[model samples]
Each structure stands twice: as structure tokens, then as C-alpha cells.
Target: MALKDEKVTLAHGGGGKAMRDLIEEVFTSVFRPDGMEDQARLQAAALADPGARLAFTTDGFVVDPLEFPGGDIGTLAVCGTVNDLAVGGARPLWLSAGFIIEEGLDLALLRRVVASMAAEAEKAGVRIVTGDTKVVGRGMADKLFITTSGIGVIPPGRDLQAANIRPGDVAIVNGVLGDHGAAIMAARGEMALSAEIASDCQGLGHLMEAVLAVAPGLRAARDATRGGVAAVLNEMAAAAGVAIEIDEAALPLRAEVRGLCEILGLDPLYLANEGTLVLFVPEHEVAAALAAMRATEAGQGAVAIGRVVPGEAGRVSMRSAFGGLRIVDMLVGEQLPRIC
Candidate 1:
């Protein structure tokens, strides 16, 4: 193809000379700045020891209407990766981005998303050192998809996991719940009443840093993403072979989100969240943990919502607003399947 008449072809996904040509010509050349490629390898080589334990995680992004009211796919992808590292008690250092672009996606739009991702990386003090790209036939794939892989190093003398949970532990949330899911529904014109609900898609590392600084012995922390706070709690209960009792009255629910959930017949407890976290702390240290969380942007709405109990493991029960009790279960199929 001539310089002025280039077209994407199936060869782009082959990982061969033609594939490299497409990636070099269409992707890196368009989105990356100088010295951007292969930074992961370069940084990994410089680690204190190449054999050190590394925290690795990967996720795929395919939210519809990529650009939403509060955020787009690029920002969510970056925040998701960083939040995972943060909650795992690791210092995020590097990332690898993989893109699958539909054949006819606007080059300018792709550029904008890539730039937003770069900005997020800079904010989190992480670098996108390596990546791959493939373009499919226009009708064969969605507009664009992003898969981000992150690597971080855990600090010494601090350990956290589901198995650490036990009876007499308190459960806390970083902030009010269900905002992100509500925002996405509103942005998509699925909600009847329109308020300026925004997706809380932000990196929670800074907030986690604040809490860990004060309580290095923090038991367990998880971002309330797809399955929300309710789903995460159930997972923890099962993992630790314990049961959890949550006070519905104590669960923070913004009036707007709550109202929408009721109208739509949706349970806010199992809704989605992008920037919120559910953490388990020792009963005695709940106050300090809540205080530290409230001090950070990601956790200003933090609150103690429940406690751990021993009984039937893997189950979560909630006190109703009417003083009744009910079960909170995992999302059956998909609440927002590709909203990640």
C-alpha cells in the first residue's frame, strides 16, 4: 500500500513482519511518545533482584460507549490495574497494554483514549513499557478493547489475604456504594430520572497507601467492582470459612443511587463500583482504619458496615432497613457484563 492509501488487513494480527509493520505504523507511532516501548522489560531488569516476588494481574476492558459521563475505557483500564496492585499491598511499577481495534475505528478517537491511558499511568507513577495491537475487520469486533497487565512488588513484613479473616473482624467500605453502576446506567440513557451521577472510576492506590501507612497489618482489602461490596464479602466469607453479618442501615447509600436502585428493582448491595473498596480489619483497630480511609480522596465516604461471624461459611446475610434480615447473593449472570 502507498503512504497515502493505506488500509488495514488481516495480516495485522499475525505477529509477523506484516503485523509488526501494522503495530509500528498504526499503533505505537500514533499513541506512544518517545522511549515508551519495552519499558517493562527495561524496568524489570533493574529491580533490586530479578528473583523477587512480583504481583501480577491482568484485566480486559470493553465498556460500551467507551466515553462515559465520568470516565472512558482508558481511565478505567488504568485505574483498575492500579487499584488491584494497591489493594494487594504492592507498589505498582509497570504495565503492559494490549489493544484490539475494529478496522474502521476513528484514528483520532483511538489516539485520545491512548493519551488518556498515558495520563493515568503518569498519575499513578507507573509506565506502559510494552504492548501489542491487532486490528480486526470492522464488523467482526467492537470499536476497541483493551487488556491491561500490571506488575508490582509487595512490601516486606505485611501480609493480607482472605484466609486471614476470622470471627470478630469488622468490615468497612471506602465510600458510598453503587455510584459507578448508577452513573453508567444514566450515561446510557437507561435511567428514567437524570441526575449528574458519575462513574467513580479512579485509582485507589493513594487511599490504600494512607491506610497501610497507618495499619500495615490490615487483614484484607478488595475493590468493589463488578460484584460490588456484597459479592466481595461473600467471597471473603467463603475463602475464610466464615460468615458475615452486615447492617443495612449502616451501609452507605447515596440518596440518588438508592432511589434509582429502588425504581429499577435493582439491589444496590450487588451493584457495581469502580472506585470503592471493601476491607476487613481487626475489631479493635476499626476506628483507626476508618479514620485513615476517610482521609483520602478515594475513601472520604468510608464507613464500618458490618462484622465477620462464624457459622455457615461462604454466605452473607444483611439486616434489612425494616429490622428484618435477608440474604445477599452473587450476581447470577452479569449485571453489566462488559462494563469493566
Candidate 2:
């Protein structure tokens, strides 16, 4: 209620009382950072460990519809940054958000987005300590775009990387694939298709922690975001200098997602996912890893989808349900743009 305008204007971005009111009422009020300084002065006990390492990552989020079925751009921004750090075996701690908001955007919508960001950060155990906002002319930008940078700590002696994967490693996914993409596509309503799919948008820091607790030898994990599971699998194979073979029957997918892809003539493997991730763990520890993952809310659908093997390096193949093999290559181009 502090902001008097129903829609944002260029004055809101100017360094004046309007801008200050917007920032204080819309953003900082919800984030509640320790101070209003231009930069966040961060300190954490985990960083005090002599052998611990710092992990930093930044990502930008833009989707056709700012709000979606399961999540809006705000939820996507936080979860995406948190998952980026979590997949690298980091304990996410802090984040910075930057907003490029268009004039005429509803003030209520901006408030909702800020609230969503704060809630997700709390759930992911991180703080939004600093942020910047700019309002542009109506046609100069979309309704809103968010860029998030995250900071995390890697415990001493924990070095998870794709190159650490070995031939005997097994691949596991956190949950069903293609739901996010399918949900977005259906939400667009361009094809007259209807289905009850929601974006699996969620933070994976807790799930990663749970798995690492039980399977210390876990190799690496990648969130199937822009390019989906096939993209992650190919990257893992190429980085580890090994071949990956996934069983078609083992891929966890919903029947609605399958039907959507079939109707659109799209391959499900190329579909994007927000909460799904593929990880590699030693064959000996697959059971433990899957159990640990399933115990977490973000990983209940965890399953072994594939295994590493000795073959032509950087090659990935899929075994069909009928017992036939086909190469799964890097996606030549995007199947859906602006998916993340």
C-alpha cells in the first residue's frame, strides 16, 4: 500500500523518492536484509573452515508468461539459482537479485513476485541480501526479467565433478521428466491442448544434501533445465570420457507428458525440466543414493535411468523398450525457446 501507483512508471527507477518507496515497500520489506548498503557484507560459519571452497553462479530467467501453473518467474529465478549451486555439491547460502521491470507492469504483480522470491529463498536456506531494480519504458522490455546470482560453500574434501565419473557409475534422475515443458506449452494454449501438468519448479539443495549424506562418492549432478535430460546426459558423457546408456523403460515420465510430446511430434528427451536432475553415483552405491533421494520431498521419484560404460568416449545411447539402441545426441537446436 506504500506505493500509490497501480502500475510502475519510469519515475520508479529514477533515484528519487518514488524509487526509494518502490524499493522499500516492494522489495527490501519482504527480503529484510540486515542492512540497506549497496553491497551485502556476508559472513558464514561454513566459510570459516580452512579447507572449504566457495561456489558462485549467476543465471537469468525469462518466460513467455511471467506466471505459470506451478511457478512464476520469481519462483523460477530462486530455484534455478539454488539448483545451479546445489548440483555442484555446494551448500547454497546467499543470493542477489536484479530486476528489469517494464513500465505499466502491475504493482501488485511485482509485489507477488518479490514475495515468491523471499519464500523460496527461505525454503532453500539462503538469503536475498542485495538486489537492484530498474523500470524501463513499456515497450522497451517484457513485463519483467530477473537475474539471480548465488553463493555457496563446498565442504572440505568434497569434490564432485563430471570428470570424476567412472565406467561403473550409474545415472539417476530426481523425478519425472518433461512436466515443466509440457505445463508451459499447455499453459500457452496455442495448440488447443489441455492437460493438468504443473512445472516441477523447486529447490534441490536439501535433496542434494540428503543424497550426499548417504552416498559420499556421488560423482556429479546437472539440472535438466533448458535442454532437458538428454542434454545433461550428453554433457556428463563427454566430460567423463565415457559412454552412457539409458534404458527407455527406466525413464520416469508421466503419461500426459508422453501424449503431449507425441501430439507435438517432439521428443520428450529434449523437453525442459525445472526440478528434475540427473546424477552419477558408483554402481555399488546406487541403492543408497536412490534411497536418500527418495527420502527428500524434491526427490521422491528418484530412479536409476542409466549407467556408464566403456565405449567410444562422449557417446550416449538409449535402449528402447523393444530392446533396440539409438544414439541420443546433443540437441542441435532448442526445442522450445525461453523455457527457463
Candidate 3:
């Protein structure tokens, strides 16, 4: 039998009876998945559906403190994987989780993390189909690290890619940025000041569905995670060999976040966000897309922030409020490591 009140130990990862007991009592109990096979098998008929394409993505999470404002590592892992598929215009379906844990960690903490993952999976309408777990010596591994992989289905003709970006295309963001990064920084207690920021960690599958239903011609979409919107915009420009110009006056930023960034000498554009998305659509379809995004609770703060333009290839520039221009560059090194 699994030890209900004891801490995790190396034996739990020995692939013996202790491992089986732990798996059944913790992960299996919470997930209660329909099947428990060596590999998940999908019916051929499902894959043969007309216009269906599969999207697969994986992410790793090692946020310090395990838990934070608005979310924990568990929530981060599931949402990060789901957003990766959503941005590709895919409907998330199944997920696999892997855990690397430090021995002597509290069993209650593991239960909490697994339960959080299950909750997020349900919210995104995805199932945790399979997973593996390992336990290492206390100092050899962090408290807990999780990696999640997901598969999603893309409908016919819903091809979205940076290569499709065109001049005059509109740039829009679903909501505010830098909340997740700011929250994590504050949670670490490394800085002296505090703010009312909370990590914007949540699933974006439903929001993506709403937008796609209204504006099927969306050229491309990217989740501004690591390196924030700056990185994504730079990549889009480089990939499409076009120039992107954003307006400083139109950026969606919270007052607390702005103040926090200034105080810390960090650029909000370089900070990370979990629940935000950057979208590209032809100018003609911008209105329809904005309307659709605003209809969802997660997208109520949507706004058009800029436009694609013709300039030096692979360049991103921002028009300042004072009518000046500044280049938005990629981050050189890690601003906040283990942030995801």
C-alpha cells in the first residue's frame, strides 16, 4: 500500500511495487482517465476526418516556490502546453505529463500539484492520457519539475503561420502583458517593493475557438511567453521578412506592472506572460476579429496595437507617443531564469 502520510522517497521511483502503489493512489486517482495502456491508441476513423490536421507541442515548467499568485507550477504546465496548440489554431485534445521530484518532499504537495493539473486539463477540454514520474535525491533535483506534451486537431484550411503575415495586416493582443513575470518576481521576494500583480495563468483554448469561429482568415497567432511580445514580434518579422511597427500609446499595460518594470530597470516588452496572445490579421478582418475576441471573458481587453509595414526586412520598430521611433530588439540573455 502507498504511504498516505509519508514524504516521497527514492523507492517510489524504483519501478517496483512502491512505484505502482504511488501511481495508482495519486495520479491515477486524480486523472481517472478512461484507458491505461502502454500507449494511447486513437481510432483510425477519427484521424481520417476530412480537413483534420494534428498539432503537437511540449513544454517544461520549473517555477521556483512551486506555487504563486493566481497559479502554481501545475497550472502553468497544463496551460503552457495548451496555449502552444491553441496559437496554432488547433483544438487541444490529449496530454501527457512527466514529473521529476526531489525525494523527501511532502506527499501532500505532490497531491496538490497533480490535482491542479487535472483541473486545468478539464478546463481546457483535454485529457491527461498518459504520464511518468521519477524521484531523485533531495539535492539532486528541485522540489518538483513538470513537463507536459499535448496534441490538438486543426480544421481544414485553417493554416496559420508567420509566413502568411502580409503588409497592412493588423496586430492585436487579447489582453494586458507582463502580469505573469511581474507576479513571479514579486513572489520571489528578491525585490523590496510589492505590487498587486498576479500571474495571468489560464487556458486560452476557448478564447481561440471563439476568435477562429468569427475570423477564419487569421494570418498567424503567437503566445507571448518567454521574452514576451518583443521576442514574438521579432521572430515574425524575421520569418516573413517584413517589418512590424507597434504604437507605444496603444500597448495594454497595467499601472502596477509599468511601475514595477521602471523600478526594476526592466522592459515590460521583455517580460513574460502566460495567458496573452499576439494575433495577426488583414486590416479588412481586424474589426471582426476584435469583436469575436471581446465576446470571450478571457479576451475582454482585446485591442489593436499596431500594423505590419514595409521597411527593412526582419525589423520591428515602435512608434513612440512623442512621434519618435525606437527599435524593439530580442533579449540577449535570460532576464528571469526558470520563469516558465
Candidate 4:
């Protein structure tokens, strides 16, 4: 191994032998890109299709604690960018990762994060084609921060968008919500809480592919990330000029997450999620969509939670278990910071 030091130093970012060693041993070796070029030379058959379109998305991961229950910053970075493209009905193909490491941080930890990114990219059927690494003073950054940009191909005839949603469209979610947020909170230990909840951090590219395969008329999908499912529902309703009504009894939530929210006087609807996604399909294809999603590992808990209705435009409401209706408005402020 060329990297003899146990911890990173400023020399690693000086574009010297130390930098080369760090890049070779820690990142490039695991990712194995085509070359060490300043940019990736890319080619794909999907791009050659006449009406196919390109999809690109970038995201930065600064989740506190660096490592959490179910995933770490690396897992979050790759999956986050991949899901961003997947929700658009794109087949994620490539990713570019950039790392900012704090001086004096353990090299072993960095290696582990890089390895996790490699494993996740492979599982999602994407390649980490290019990346950059930099080291900052100890106090200049957290242990590490990662930014990822992804590229994918949206096949011809696939025009999924929130604006395509309409009344009678069925709303479905892949799995339980609020687990990621609750897991982060418990990991922080500031609240003096304890729970066995694991962050629901996983890639959804395969799940989306499966759903689209059976339900070709899938209207739209949104990964419920920062603002959980409520934010996504509101966005879809606003884009489609429609109303969304969800059944409270039909929502999928873990008991621990529900308990945590109730204890903290928080609404689980606003909690963040990493792998969860909300999708809308026409009434006729709802069963097929649900079956297709449930058949996938990432969406085994898929279920119908709501439906679009003819009512006030941009309105979202929840039919409580008590059978009363109340508006589920857009999140007003941050529910959990640095959550993903």
C-alpha cells in the first residue's frame, strides 16, 4: 500500500505523490474507472436511440456522524444521486464523486466510505467514472463530505413527470416512512433516546425499473427525501393542479418511528427518508403497479396510500383514522437538519 499514514494530512491534497497514492489506493482502485483522465470518456447504446433523452442530477451529502445505522455518508451519496435520476424514469448509468476530507481524519475510515460507494454503485448498475478528492484543515470540515453527480438515459416514450398526474390517479409508496429521520435522531444521542430503528437507505433504480415494466402508464414518482412523503405529495398536487387525499390508516410506518414522533411532538409526515418513493399510476394500472413494486427488493412494502381527486387545486389532505379530513400542507420549516 502506498498510503503508509494512518491519518490524512494536507500533503495528500497538494497534488504530489501523496495525492496520487491516496487516490490510487483509496478511491480509484475500488471504483476502477476506465482511465485517470480529467474527464470520463463515455458511450452508451441508450444514448444512440433516436428519441432517448439524457438525465443528469447532482447532490451533496453532509449527514452528520458520518456513519449511521444502515448506511453512512458514502451510501447516502451514491443512492441519493441514483434515486434522483430513477424517479425521473431514467436508467442511472454513471456517477462522479467528489470528496472533501478533514485533516487528521483516519485513513481507514476514508477507505471504508470509498468502498461503500463502490459497492452501492455496482449494486445500482452504475459506474463511478470520475471524482476528485481534497483535504482540509481539521476544523475546516466534518470528517468528510461527499458530492455526487449522476447521468442516466431516459428512454423514448417515457415522459414521467408530476404534471402528468390527474384526478383518479392512485398514489402509492414503496415502504415505511420516517425510519431514516428517526434513525439519525437516535444516532445523534443528543435527545437521550434509544431505538433499534435502522435508516431506510437503499437505491431505487431497480425498483423503479420493475414498476415501469408492468405499469407503462406510471404517471410520476418522487423520492421522499428531506420533507418525507408530505412534501412530495404537495409538489405533485401543485404541478398537476389537482388535490391529493391520503388515508391515514393506509400509511406504512414503523412502530418505533411513530412512537418517536409522538414523544417528540413531531409529525412523521415531515420526517426524511432515503429509499422511500411516492408514485402515481392510473386506476386501471394500480394493481399492476403495486404488484410490480412489491416484487422488487427495494419496494417490498409497496401499498396504495392515496389518490388524486377533483377538488381545490394544489390541495393535499389526509383522511384520519377517525374519518375526519385535514389538510396535509407543505412542510413549513426544517423538521430535521443534516438528515440526508
Candidate 5:
């Protein structure tokens, strides 16, 4: 029962004294210096925010290893949920975290994750308003898993959706593709290879604001997470009933990432990305959108890679570097699971 020998146990989730002690000594100690409460309360005026619409999103993180090159699971939780709201033209404000910790897990590891989450929230200017914790048997779950839900304010007349995509709309990526996936894969150490790669995990709320400020007519925006840009484009093409054509040579892929994908027989376009985003902007606004994206740290490498066209609805094609056309289909199965 002492801190020195402490490890997560079912009693820590029993809603009893053990639960209180665990939460107080660990989560609250990092997440809230003030105190812990059953629920987080905010002023009505704070939520109103000039009558802006609310964007709500929730995501789960079960990434293996829990930590990777550029970030850890804690940072991923905050960035992933915040990016969800950002892509919808929202300014993220608050988040709720839930942890499913496995018995026998090291308390120190849990503290490290909690600390990372707290730090990332501060950087993104969001609050960890409320949270819950549960402990399962050692074999019932992985070492730890986190679920984060967030809410944000969307300005008036800033609606964004894939259905708004039209012919001539351009597809743009914020940065190099597949860094997150490649980093995670390399971290796993299963391939017995080495490459200098890091997960491209970071908040995009500021980048979205900059682009929206200049190109309010942006049709759609999405973080290239689980399925990467290929999935995003396929979904958007289907939603907008248009075909998407991308130039293979235009994709900004890192040499390390490309090499990793090549050795593993994976397509960088299909690999996951944590910080990258895909934006669809009208032809007239493409230049301004790129300019706005390049102005922000998160979007400095932004480039227009493709365009929408009239064809079979829901089709995504790429012009191969070898001068042939190929379909970029939705991944039949996960290429790298638990990369996020």
C-alpha cells in the first residue's frame, strides 16, 4: 500500500479509498493543482463566446510502447482531439481524459504520461477539465489506454465539410507524410532497421486559424491520422461525389520515411500521420491558402499536391512518378496498427 511498492490494481478502480488515494496521488497531482472534482464547471458566458457554434470530438489512444520519437501517448491524446476540432474550424477550449490502466503497471510510467498530457494541454491553451480512471486486470488490457474528448468554438460562417469539395478544388498537405507511422514502426524495433524518424505529433489549432483567416472559402480540412491522406481524399471524394487526382512527385515525403516504406512494402500515402493535415481549397483560394499555411510553424511545408475533377464519384487516383496512373484505394487492412 506504500508508494514505493505501489502498482495499479483493481482496487484502484473500485470507487473506494484505494481509488481516491491513487487518483489524488497521481492524476490530480499532475492534472489539477487546485483540486479534483466529480465534474468541471464553467461560466455560461465562457461557453457562449460571442454565440459561436460548438465542435465536439472524442478519440481513443492505445498506441503500443506509449512513447515514441517526437511524442508520447499523452501528447497524442491532446493533439489528436484538438486537431479534430481544428479541422472543423473550431478553436479548442476544453478536454476530458479517461484512463484505463492495467494492474502491475509501473506507477512511474503513469506519472510520466500524466505529466506529458498536462504539458501538452498548456501548450495548446486547453484545460483538462475532468477525468476518470479505471484499472483492469494485468491481462485484461494493455499497459495503459487513454480516451480524450474535447469541445471548441467555431466562429460564425466558418462551416467546413468534405461535401463542399468541388471540381477544381485543390488538395494540400501541411507537411511530410508518414513520419508518425514510420517513427512508430522503427520504435517497435521489430524490423531490425534504423532510421532517424519521429512522430509528427503536435497541435494544429493555430495553423487552422491562420488558413481560415486567409481562405475562409476552404471546402474541407482533415488531420491525416489513422488512415493518412489517402483515406481522407477517398472519403472527401465520396462525400463530394468527385474524383481526386494527385501528383506522385508532389507528395512531400522524407527520405527516411520513404526508405522505411520501401523496405516494408508500404505506401507512404497510406501510412498514418499525427500532425499533418489535408486541406481542400477552391482553385482561386489555393495560393492564399498555401501562403497562410506556410506562415505557421505547423504548416511551413504546406504544398498543393492535387485537384478534384469530374469522374466516377469516390475515386482517388495518383499520377505515378513513372508516368502512369494508379488508384489510391482505402487501406484494405491496417498497415501499422497502434501507430497513433
Candidate 6:
């Protein structure tokens, strides 16, 4: 007659009275006033824009395997949504989740995913105050899918957008590349390499703080996830009507991830990165951005990768260390199709 702890039934996800009861019994129980004050208030608070002007974005997670080395779908969902706001130069604030679970899914696994999501939200300084869930037949869906909507506030006197890009502006990545894609491939047993390539999945809240602290005026920013750095640059350049020139030697790639990509005939430049950022800023602000970025954990391998040029605004070109040059075209379709 009642749902038990560690066991979730269909009633938990239903829109009926049972769902409301579950929300009060468990969700509220974790974030009452007795807990961490700020986090507690966040957990129990309703959706309200913290800033006069807000930037909102939503993202969905359906990474194959759902669980990976550095993170799971839960954390990925939170990180992806928040990163969207952060790279847009906004201070991420709130998140709303919508879950769709396959029938016959393990109750324990679902709980694990939510727990991880809660922990991630706490770390990112965002709250998951509103959400809905549904169940479908086992074969009709993946084990579980999470969709998150994020809201954030942009700081004052600091205007950042794709249109702000200009020729001579430099591009810099917060850290290493291809870790997330490589990690997922390794998890799926897609390649055999001597080294381990765990996903670079992580939160960039602190990293964002560091960059803005020094280079407060940024032109534009984008977190290189599905399309990697190359595609992201192309998007920004095209949107801003500028050509992007990146130094192949400057794009930081971890040896382990690179080795795996090489062995598998994959280009590291096109691989996804969950915890990296591609920033385009004025040439004068480049050093400051680099300094600020390297100040955070997520930006340990920060490097100045490229610059904007006048022609072929939407095209990306890579310059070899030895002086050769080649065009870096966007992927026809998704490289790692299901990568979050």
C-alpha cells in the first residue's frame, strides 16, 4: 500500500497524489531548514530569477551506458546545463529536471542517479527544485534519460556574445581535450589502449569565477562538448562572421586520450570534452584569461589555441607545428553520436 525506502514504484513518478507524497517525504526531507542554510534554502526555494536579466538554457543527457568513470548521467545532466550558462558568462543559479525512465529499471540505480544529481547540484551551487518523471516500456527507451533546464544571471558591465567576436581576437581552451569522448569509448570497450582515458566530466563554476576575476570583459565563450573545440569555434566564427585559426600544437590534448584516438584512427581535435571551455576574447585580454583559467582545477592545461581572421567566417583552419595548414571542417553529423 506504501512506497518503501530503497524501493521506488510507478507511483513515485506518477502525476497523481502519490507523486506529491513522494516529493514531500523524500525530496523535502533532504533540504529542510535543519540542513546547510544556503543549500537548504536553495533546495526548498521556488524558481525566481536572481538577476535583473537572466540567461536560460536547457539540455538533455542520454549518454550510452548512463554511467561512466568520471560521472554518470545525473552529474552530466547537471554539468551540461550549468556549463551552458557559465560559458555564456552567467552565474548559474537554478535547474529543473525531467526524467524518463524505462520500465523494469532497477530502483537502486535510479536512486543512485538522483543522489548523484543532488550532490552535483550542491557543488555547482544550483538547486533542482522542480521536476517531473515518467515511465515507458523497457524496450521503448534507454535505461534512463535526464533533461535539465538552467537559469543564470549575467554580471554587470561585462557583455559577452558570439556577435562580439572580431579579427585578431584570440581563442583559448580552459584545459585538455577529448577526455570525455575517450573515456566514454573506453567505458564501452570501443578501443584497447595501454593507457586509461577517463571522461573529463566536471563542474566549471570555480573555473568560471577565476576567468572573470581577471578578464572580466570577454567577447564570447562556449563549452566544447559534443562537437569538441573545432566545431564550437566554427559556430562562434560563423555566428560572428569571422574566420577562426587555431594552432594545432596549441590545442592541449592529454597523452593517454591522444594515444587512444590515434590507435582508433580518431582525430583528437574532433573528440568531445565535458570539462573544457573554448573562449574567444580580445588579444589584450588573452593573457589575463589564460592566467585566470589556469587558476582553477578545470583549467590546469589551459592554452591559447587560435585566433579570429577576416575571411571564411564560418570556416576553421588548423596550422601545423611544422608550418603546414589545413581546413578544419565541421563534422557531417555527430562524431560520438550519443555522447552527452
Could you tell me every candidate's TM-score relative to the true structure? 0.89, 0.99, 0.97, 0.99, 0.95, 0.88
Better of 1 and 2 by lDDT: 2
Could you tell me the lDDT of residue 42 within candidate 5?
A: 53
Give one digit per residue, the lDDT tens place, for model 5 in 216-314.
899989999988889988988989899999999999999999888888899999889999999999989989989988988899999999999778899
Residue-wise C-alpha lDDT for candidate 4, range 59-167, written one tens digit per residue? 9999987889999999999999999999999999999999999999899999889999999999999999999999999899988999999999999999999999988
Q: Which one is best on lDDT?
A: 4
State each model's C-alpha RMSD to the native: 3.3, 0.7, 1.4, 0.7, 1.8, 4.0
Q: What lDDT does the true structure give each of the candidates?
A: 0.81, 0.93, 0.90, 0.95, 0.89, 0.79
Please give, for residues 39-86, the per-residue lDDT of candidate 3 as tens digits.
776543445789799999998999987888989999999999999999
Candidate 6: residue 22 Cα off by (Å): 5.4
Q: Between which residue pairs do clashes occur in model 4? A: none
The sequence of per-residue lDDT tens digits that candidate 1 reaches over residues 57-113 is 999998877888778899899999998988887878888889887876765567578
Off by over 4 Å in 2: none
Instruction: Judge candidate 3 at residue 320 and give its lDDT.
Output: 97
Candidate 5, position 263, lDDT:
86
Better of 1 and 3 by lDDT: 3
Candidate 6, 278: how far from true, in Å?
0.4
Number of clashing residue pairs in every model?
1, 0, 0, 0, 0, 1
Cand. 2 TM to true fold: 0.99
lDDT winner between candidates 2 and 4: 4
